[model samples]
Target: MEFIDLLLLFVTLFLAIIWFKYWSVTGGGQKNLPPGPPGWPIVGNLIQVVLQRRNFMYVVRDLRTKYGPIFTMQMGQRTLIIVTSSDLIHEALVQKGPIFASRPADSPTRLLFSVGKCAINSAEYGPLWRTLRRNFVTELINPARIRQCSWIREWAMDIHLKRLEKGALETGSVEVMSNCRLTICSVLICVCFGARISEARIKEIEAVLKDVMLMTAPKLPDFLPIFTPLFRKQLKEAKELRRKQMQCLVPLVRSRRVFVQGGRCEESNIGGDMEMVSPIGAAYIDSLFGLEPAGRGRLGEEELVTLCSEVINAGTDTSATTVEWALLHLVLDQNIQQKLYEEIVNSVGKKGSITEENVESMKYLGAVVKETFRRHPPSHFVLSHAATKETELGGYTIPAHANVEFYTAWLTEDPSLWKDPGEFWPERFLEGDGVGVDVTGAKGVKMMPFGVGRRICPAMTLGTLHVYLLLAKMVQAFKWVPIKDSPPDPTETFAFTVVMKTPLRAVILPR
Candidate 1:
């Protein structure tokens, strides 16, 4: 078997070599196309990219500076198009959004079985994606639906409020960032899974899922299809991650969907009572379960289950990371905290009491959150998307299956659009400081915290409200202090989302 595998690998490599030579010779016609760092022969830059957390952002930025706005490199046989400048990013992602809106059809995707049912994250630009996107937009992330679930936001905030009081009285110090992340994780999990989940359970789940995610980091085998014979363990580990993920994810999804459509997500005194049900709308689980058997299209049971898991992983981590960053900023700038507290007090009173009715009244808190999101995007880039067809973009053809990435963090901080882009100033968004947030899609392409175009995040509004209301509640109730003489370190370590090299350690003091 080993001999046969090695023989097959060499045969595949021969074909790949011929195909790559053709591509390189044919691609040489692009006179105006951007340049990039010199890559090794055959190997290209596959090793650097597959190293997982190699800060593709900084590398791409450096390439843009050295080369031009748009650049290209080869990660194994996979052709990577990196757009660093905001102009190029906008031209590719927004102006030509329709063309660059799909995800690559690749071997790793097939191996992982993520072809369909992943919704907005990995869904192809088609009807099912459109329907699912619409369903989420109209029912789940809608303004009215978000308003209706104001209680859930409040409940999540109240947990932190209680913690703030305890932290203020006990230590005059707290890991506010950790607590914020935990609360957001809990809320988004409850919202997505339609089950009652605790912070302990989230941490437990994160512990295991963290290990599972480690195995699926973009492998060299993922790019160099011919080399996969030597990396069979990677293939097996990817499947195992999916299997383990399903072990935890599927049953919860099944149970919660049953509860949601049956209206059991809101039952009372059901804390530890496994027999009881709690109502929380037709949460994401119900949506997946409902779509599972309707096999009018390509989605199968396994694919549905996989997408259900994607729902949890995507919604939970990003929101939690954003909340962490927001709290970190709040702790770093006490004057901002004081201003936010005053706004919350003036709007919702001194207890930090907020309601569905009062949410819109806290305008300053909203601006502050919009600014925070501008500063720290949850993910360095939006999920990679692929163009479905050969299409023109930025005066060049984006060939079919070419992966496109949008750097929301970079776009939000672009100096051309933002005055003092690197500076953390909530006032930039206040009224007349040459900065204004166009969340309603009313202005130029300035900042896209929720992303822009068709694949924009559905829960952007609710997520924003959650960040504002929760942070306001915390700031109103407590004064925050970093553990050291200075503030939380701004240096970040990359994860699926950016994490502080040192988590913000602080003591919470009473107002």
Candidate 2:
């Protein structure tokens, strides 16, 4: 029976390949598409990509060099338009924002986790996307809300410092990335659910979300639906993962709903003294509960779970990975570490704790954060973008079906844009051409660590603040030194985000 199933699958694949090859030949091809290496019928450069999957970004970098900044690659049934230059990225994502705003279709596994394209990141560019994105920004991560959440940051930092101190005492060194992940996840969980959860609970939720991220990463079936049946085992695993995810998050959503209802009743009973009866908690979920998209009612429990998961997953790994990269640089360069420590000292002046205001005043610290973002962006590519309609960009026809992605790491490292793109020099931001650069890409995209234009990550401000505060607290709390016989290596790997291939291990001495 197993042999029969395998034989049937091979026969189906062979026939599908023939049909795809014929369709490719007979289909109307768009003229003036960006030049790219010729690919085999049906597969179309996928073999090469798979052959070099481990260092995919490096492969893209070589292609950018060979084919110039704007080029194309056909990956299975998908047409990938790769843009590596800042000017071109700005042109497409900002100057022509609307045309390039919508996202490509989600994979089958992603659809299960995203609850059928209901999450903001996975939603199509339209009323639903706008409603969800606006609610997240205004309600949870706006400037005023961030100020209100300063206490949460402080609380997380205290726990983080204690853990690091304890680890150093017992083990003689601390693993930086895991601790950073824990701290960021704790802060985001509070912000998302408006509950001060136990540490064990936080770790549980974090582990589940981490599994979801790894499970939903791009796969062969994602690019080629015809191949999905061959991946039944993986698909079954994804469904189980989603069930586990709901098990972890749906209860929090229900609890928050009850809290909101109870508060409303109390406010009515007490002559509408809402402030006395209820305070702001679960800002993200609260906003979701109130949100009514066009034609659709308030989000259902599954949708709420998906959005809340998006919030936590989006903010946690990116910020934590960036903090790890920054700490690794500081550990490798003692002079840089000493300079940053001096800045923290001078700004706070032996204060017991580093305040948000203190972080604001430390210019050098800000420079280091910016430099870290440029050198080691959390992800090498932004979320895949799609054209709303057939459009022309940089004298090439962009078919509506093509998946447009910007190679952000290449843009930051382009020699023409910076003096020493290879060096981890924060001083570049203090002077030189890097001064006064805009990260939002509003003025021009010198380096887009967070991305740019209409579809930029909504939590950009919150994410940056996390990195800035955590890096400040970590540096001020200890003197970081490289572990003996295990010097820090900045080799890169693709995880949920771009992280150090070998996690940073450093000795932390209390200051």
Candidate 3:
């Protein structure tokens, strides 16, 4: 080889190396960032994540342990921040709530919730998301509204008890996870769409949602921007999903509840709370369908349509998973289960039924729920947040648009926060006057089940009540035990909402 050719080859290799480094640190200086496991050039964590054959939660948690609570993972050239620290988490998420509230475009929910219409989670931080979030809490999941839906608890519990009774008679075993999913989904479906979903129908939705969820599932797509066009797998799935979703959800959306006044039935209350309303009002849709001018916050008609599906997904998914996990723990741990059961029986037994108003007095029941949330958070990691401008956290510089992710699962189990973090004992929460832990150990940076600050999940209360009431009723009606040798393994499932690795199978022994 000629000397000139050798020199050219060296130059070419050097330029490629420099370009790669430049790509990784484009938005921020990438200096003094927290550490992460070294990865193959350009690909970083993506290969590890995909290769694990799907242990995303454990892999991420393991990384956090090696790299501390606040660390970074590189996907190709894109920088992904993984926060495990409560302190910096507060600084970034809670303290800087508004700035960090925005969720970047990703697969799945972009189609499911955003419907290509930017709803709360999909809509970037702006006036439109603000209006929508406000409307959701004020109208749908408000304290009074949740209270009014007390019948949901009775009806759903009734259906579930009947299911378990029949199942035990036939096989002496039942899958509690399926029951939990149906109960939680039915409650949300009833509350949001004002409809009761039978178990078979719920299974049908779950199957379709499973496909749509995979197609739309979030990964480090930001790493491969050029591949975005190809990644429309979910986008296409979203369109098909929107059709299936409409077949079920739309009819629920359209049918108006006949108002009974003085024993007379008439046109339903459309604008009032009595009518079934979309998260976004019907007037907004009429205007959009009519091709009226674009409304506030630079939003268009397409985004307007997406809001309904977003409500269904957001209102349903994590909450159902959460309810499932909590009941699993309560049932598998007979001691804890009976302790809570006793508390419920003592408080509401003579009342012949449970009521939302009386639930506040059942402090131990509340603690069991809190402990369940702490041990098994719905999302091990939260939606990625981008710094709007240069900010400092943990004595490190987080430059503008640098993607930051928070890991709540580790934070919840961190040694600094709790005693016996690994154990499923609910009594940890039962400390301090028996009301359990009121500190909310993972709210920001520490533990964020429903997320934090301004963009905190509006459905937090609704979800909490839904979970507690279901568990409360399940306990009140029957005694739960594992199905013979079944181990309700705490090992995790990789999905949109982290689920039990094994669907909990148990026997429902009636009290």
Candidate 4:
């Protein structure tokens, strides 16, 4: 029996090699494809990636040096076209927006969480995507809605500052990232469900959502569906995680549904002191309840859960991560921190709590946030984009359905684009070439932290507001100093977002 099993394993390997060779010859035969390093059979560049033992971002950075601005890689059955420079990115994503507006087809695990691509980010460029994205933008994050939601930010900020003070007094040092995550998650939850949930419940939702994000990340079976049979355990685990996620979020959806339908929430005790249901500040779920996608009926229970999950997950981690990075830079550069604090104090008298209006007025604070985004983007790469159909980009035939990667981080760091691109100097935005730089990539693609063009993140405004409010208030409430015997390190690793290799630890003193 052992001999038979060995023979079977060998036969399977032989068959896979043959299949890989056949695909390599025929699948990548398209002429005028971008240049990349030679790949090994069966594994493509998977072995090279493994050998590097670095974050994929760094690996791609090195490859960019060798392959020029545009390149291609064969990862298993997938073809990835990586675009690194500003001009090519603008040419593809902005100049030819419609051609590159759609997302790649969802991995099976991603589809499970996205409810068959019904959510905003995963959905293709079509009526469904438009309906969902338009609803989010118009209903939840429009300028009027953002103004109305100031109370939520204020509430979350109060709790966040108190928590930071408590941690600082008790431990003499505090972990900034976790506190930031909790605060951002709390604000997002209120916006999503139209209620201020208890800290315990908020943490429960955050935990499950975090698990879902990790489990649904691209896996081996996602790239090589032929190997799906070997990943039974992983797929099963993903399903269980999705179940856990549904368990945490679906009840919130049902509660909101009741409120939207009956004009009163069944669970009055859902929030702390405030009522969970409010007609004045309608939540994202409220909008979802009313939405009818073209040809499709109102969103189903599973779709509602998925959309709400996307809202929280998308807004929470990226915003929190940016706050952490910004704080770390401030800690490293006391002069910059002091200048920003002075600006905040001058804008809103020292005794005054930092308000959104005050935040808008503080030029230095805006520059600091912009510089942080440029230095350490929330994610090194945007969500993968795919061509709607076969098209030409940068003089190469971008075959249909190939995964196109825009290395957004590389664009910000390109020396040609900025003076001293490596430095974390916010003043660069205040004067000289960096002045009036366009982040939207409309005028030109200098830098795009939140991405650009049609499919850019819908929550960009809200996300930036969260960062501005949190960073301003935190700095106003306390003085953050690096921990004794330890210094700030900006070395990054990719999690849900690109984050510090060592989480920021600091001592906080009440101002």
lDDT of 2 at 434: 80
Write model 2 residue lDDT over 1-511, tens digit each, in one string.
6999999989878967664664454222546788887886677788888987566677898899899989988777778889989889999999999999999977889989887888889888898898888888889977777887788888889999999999998999999989999999988877876666678878899999999999988899876777889999999999999999999887777766776867643322222211212244536787888789875677799889999899899999999998998998899898999999999888776455787777877888888999999999889999899999888888888888578978999877888898889999999989877899999999899898888999898898888888889998888889899988989988889997999899989999888
TM-score of 1: 0.86
RMSD of each: 4.0, 4.2, 5.6, 2.5
Global lDDT of model 4: 0.85
Q: Which ten contiguous residues of candidate 4 have the minimum total lDDT? A: 265-274
Which lDDT values do the candidates have, in the order given?
Answer: 0.64, 0.84, 0.64, 0.85
Candidate 2: residue 145 lDDT (0-100): 78
Q: Estimate each model's TM-score.
A: 0.86, 0.93, 0.82, 0.95
Give the per-residue lDDT digits (tens) of candidate 4, residues 100-183: 998887677888888888988989889999999988989998888888778889888998998988888899998989999999
Task: Indicate which candidate wins on lDDT.
Answer: 4
Candidate with maximal TM-score? 4
So what's the TM-score on candidate 2?
0.93
Question: Can you write out model 3's per-residue Cα lDDT over 257-287, one digit (the tens) per residue?
Answer: 1211122232244452334322222222322
Ranked by lDDT, the better of candidates 1 and 2 is 2
Give the per-residue lDDT digits (tens) of candidate 1, residues 187-253: 6666666555656666666655555445544656666676778877767767776676667655665
Cα displacement (angstroms), candidate 2, residue 42, comes to 1.2
> Where is model 1 more than 4 Å wrong at Cα?
1-33, 48-53, 106-117, 164-172, 209-216, 257-277, 292-305, 432-434, 439-443, 484-486
